[model samples]
Target: MTTPAPEFNKKLGFINAFTAATLMGFVGFFARHIDAQGDFIAFSRMMCGAILFFGILAYKGRIKELLAYKLSIPMILSGFFMGNCLSAYITATQHTSIANAVFFIYIGPIISTLLAVIFLKEKMKPATWFALVAVFIGMMMISGLMSVGPNGLSFGMEFSQETFFGDMMGLYSGVGYGLFLFLGRYRTEVPGDVRAFWNFVFALAGITILFIFTKPTISQMTSTDWMWWIGIGIVCGFGALGTCTIATRHLKAAEFACVSYWECVVAALFVGLLFYGEPLSSGQMIGGALIIIGGMSEVVISMLGKSLKKTDKQADAMGAL
Candidate 1:
């Protein structure tokens, strides 16, 4: 069988990453309908995701390969970080305002860029840095930090003890997420499905331990709750995460980070339409536009840079002949 073209794989990877981010945007909606403690929801999500992911592998006749794949220390660490990131973000949302939690969590992209530069020795273009700044400002606008009010866009800084703790957790969650993405990009030897399966395994284990310790009230869930849980686990877990894992193979960690910002835009649209049933503010529209433009521009510029380099090399070879 002929191998697929490299450019085709890269394009597919970009689509996969964007699609996964869009699916992840629905997570908050599902969580809102679950009526469970944060830890319980997290545990269930991971456990269910793992089961479904394994089931998929079984159906594909790859279960044995997944199970037999050697689990390296880095893989285990990545899974642990992934679990911490998800759980911390959930808990942070419970304690702090959703805006605060989301804004802090979005710091993951910046962290990912820094880590990629330091460890992977990836060069950051000035254009990419400008794009990142634009994206950050856009996210702040979407978070309503720049909303005009009676005080006229106050940049007040006040944090209660609880909020302070939650903010710290959010920052930690960003760190964990950044590390997870960096590791995934650095180590591409593992198959995406196998890596995703192991990630769920370790995440499930971590969350299960937390559940035992915290022991949040286990109330009876309605059929609706179960439906949401299944969606989060099977659909978001297997589908979103599996595709994201595949994406890491074709995109740099920094590029993937920029692409993932679409989750915020998607989430904003979803929350406005499904929950609020109201029109978005002009600020939100502007912010979302900035994010999309910045991210897409960065990716396009990077790809063009690569294409130019390839052309230059071909021209040089012809000139030498």
Candidate 2:
């Protein structure tokens, strides 16, 4: 018999969702520190993650569930897009300015929203629209597209031909991520472990194949690099993605969309303060504020809606009695 899936709890879901987003921000830390090429880093992360998740399934005697689970179209696509999203994102970090890469990839929620509306026919509530717009503005400000200068606020990105390829890769990562999230919403029945296991497996396989054509030189990694890869695999790959999959199972599209932008704030903080010695700018700080507010607004709206509906049910029951 297949192992039964766990029941969803809103509180646990929200906590896991937040943790997952926060962990995602650490990707740049690894990209900056590790000596390997992005593809190699991606491959290491996926291979190690696949091993860890596989071990988890085997140890728990849930390997049967993984094998027995049907591979639906949505599940397959989710895995494919997820593989590409991680690969492209890490590569983008290496090539482009981190701010540019972060900005482009963070548009994921917008793409996710559009797909959800079109395919799933999810209702776009007013609050959802506001949240999306706020997140967009927050990302732009944090990305330095709109900087506050000595004179005042300045608008317009001075486009450079140099970063074009990296910029496109970053955008592609966002689109791929959006597709991944959309497809994830439909595969709610799949156990998080099973889904994560397949994600790592597919990503590992896909990257290995791509390496054949590119044949880029992978620099020799130090013992420290291997150590980071292992830890990141367990933490960022397994912990982050596992919780994210769980969050998708529990949180509705409108509820968790803004909340996931925690990645932007955390990423900016880690890169700016720790590595670059750059202090938070007025725009980044304000952008961080907008992200927090936008995310909180959606969560509060969802909670209020739920509470009102619950009270209405209680009132109806009392009237019937």
Candidate 3:
């Protein structure tokens, strides 16, 4: 079988990453509808996602392959990182202000980019760097760090022992997520579905152990809550996680990170429409646009680079003949 062209693979990666990010935006909406603790929600999501994904593997006759595949240290670490990301983010929100939580968690992109550069030796063009800066600014705007105050453009910079612990948790979550992406860049042998299945399994195991100590067991959820959990797990878990994992195979961690910013845009739209019943503010609209533009710029730049390389290869072949 012929290997896919680099440009084609990158395009597929962009599609998968964007779709995954878009679907993940609905997670907050589902969480809002469900009446359960954060840990419970995390557990339920992983459990449901695991069950559904395993079912998919079974139906596709890939379960045997998945079971037989030797688990590498990186794969196991990736699963642990994924599981910790979810649980830590939930814990962070419970303790800190939403703004602080989001700010810290979104730092994952920067971390991932840096790790890719240092460890993976992925070179970034000047344009890609500029796009990263633009995206970061856009994220800050969406997080309301751009809001002016009586103190004149105070960026909501407040630190206290009260929220410090939660802020650290959020930061840890970002690191975990970044590591997950970084590790995924090396696991080219693992199928996306198989990776996603084990990710949720590890996540479920971690969350379940935590749940043993925490309140709001699965038994405590109402029928309505269960419905919401199921929806979140199947949709966000299976759809989002699965696609995002697959995307890493075709995209650099930095590129995937840029695309993941789409989640904030999607979440804002959904939350405004369904929960608040109001349009997004001008600031949010601008922020979202900036993020989209930055992400697209990175993708386009990468595609063009690949296209040029392909053209050069073809020209060389013809000259040799």
Candidate 4:
């Protein structure tokens, strides 16, 4: 009995998707500059986000909604993987270049798209194949596995052990992100805000418990560090809340995957301008371009399809009336 969402809703969804993608880029900057250690940053951000989101639920007199929704083990398991992904991706930046970390992490969409085809029985469009190819070629360029820099494209067997490890962590991040999306898309029936709240709550709980094992140097931080932690917690905390909720609502999982590619672009731009004050290299520029193209090509095509469907629906409705 539900009518198709209006074109206006779809357009608003796109705006939300774009804004979320853009804001998530700041995560790298936070990880780079926050006074607290990376693990603390991850822990604090999730904790802060959960508190804020739950507070809103309480304000709405929906605190009981959380307990009312029956939580499944798979859903909880999804949160565990998500926490690991967040920590690994942040830590990868410490071990490798932001370019490598961000690019590798953005591969989530490819994983999600493949899963959709296999598990959801979704068919791949022509654009999807092209996007896959573009994503692979672009990722290669960014990783220096197949350099397309000014030195000209070269295939090198060289791989730094440190960078290789970082890349693996980033790849794991993509897998984690993909799994999170799959859960949100196919498994959870909870409202977007509610799901987001629980995801962070679970993530926070996991981190707190995990912290007991790590013996972190939290005691050494200064007041200046505390301010950075608070700032990062507030910024990324709310950013995660808003973006994750918005992106999941209007877009398909694959579409969300595509939009997430912006996170890398945002990271590269902010990090380069703020930290290095250096221009992006030719390879990064090209790889980024291809990633953007691969990411959005399907989305654009999907929008056109939606518009046509809406027009057809309008015609049928007019005839019925």
Best by lDDT: 3
| C-alpha TM-scores of all predictions | 0.88, 0.89, 0.92, 0.84
Candidate 3 lDDT tens digits, 194-304: 888887887777766776677564666789988998898878888888788889878987788888888888887767566778576666677788898998899888889
Candidate 3 segments exceeding 4 Å error:
1-8, 148-154
- Whole-model lDDT, model 1: 0.77
Q: Determine the backbone clash count of candidate 2.
A: 0
C-alpha local distance difference test of each model: 0.77, 0.77, 0.81, 0.69
Who is ahead in TM-score, 2 or 4?
2
- Kindly report which residue pairs in candidate 1 clash with one another: none
**Model 3, residue 30: displacement in angstroms?**
0.2
Q: Residue pairs in steric clash, candidate 2?
A: none
Which portions of model 1 miss their true places by more than 4 Å?
1-9, 67-69, 148-157, 310-321
Q: Candidate 4 on 216-317: residue-level lDDT in tens?
A: 677877787777777677777656545565565566666666666665566666665567685766777786788689867867877898899989999999
The alpha-carbon deviation from the true structure for residue 94 of candidate 3, after best TM-score superposition, in angstroms, is: 1.7
Question: How far is each candidate from the true structure, as Cα RMSD in Å?
Answer: 3.5, 2.8, 2.9, 3.6
**After best superposition, candidate 1 residue 286: deviation in angstroms?**
1.7
The residue-by-residue lDDT of candidate 1 on 207-243, one tens digit each, is 7777776687756788888778777776567777777
